[model samples]
Target: MSHPQIRHELSKIETNLRIEIGQLAERKQIGIDSQGTNLCELIALLTNAALSDHPLFSQLTKLDAAFCQLDIGLYGLCSDCESEIEPERLILDPVEQRCALCAESYAHEHRHELRLTH
Candidate 1:
């Protein structure tokens, strides 16, 4: 996708994440990039560790990693296959980590392992 499109998607995801983080943290932090780090730290401290088994924590961790990938110019690439994820999918969900094929395969293999606990 074009840089502008990427930025649009990123901004959308950032906005959605900011809302969630704002609610989860109970205090909104201003700014992007830097605030992602700060909010992650605050969320982590709130989670009090041992949250890898939790889905929301995992999603936040993955999105935080996505911001790191963006910093390194690898944001939209699949983690398993190293291929560029479909542009539409990325635009729809900028935090997505896998291409369609890899995602399907992963879901097939890991379906039983998927569970969300509150």
Candidate 2:
């Protein structure tokens, strides 16, 4: 995709991520009342688990960093090969910094390294 199109898409994603993060924070801040019934307490516990270490929260953090990179004009370049990332891949995940081949290679190497360490 063109730079402008990429920028526009990333901007939209960034905005949505920020809004989601804000909502999640608000939910966290409204602590469940200790005096509530058992059901309420159970619901609150489930909500807490959903909010904490959730994939959405992690994605928000990643997208925030991606926004920073976009601001500096380095969004679509593959980190490993310094090649332009495919536009389709970018559409699938604007925060992805590496092309498919490079990402697979990196993952493979990382897994191998983990095996060695273990």
TM-score per candidate: 0.65, 0.59
Worst 10 residues of 1 by lDDT: 26-35
**C-alpha lDDT (0 to 100) for residue 64 of candidate 1:** 71
Candidate 1 lDDT for residue 39? 46
Candidate closest to the true structure, highest TM-score:
1
In terms of lDDT, model 1 sits at: 0.68
- lDDT per residue (tens digit) for residues 78-114 in model 1: 9999999998887677789999999999998786566
Candidate no. 2 TM-score: 0.59
Question: lDDT per model, in order?
Answer: 0.68, 0.67
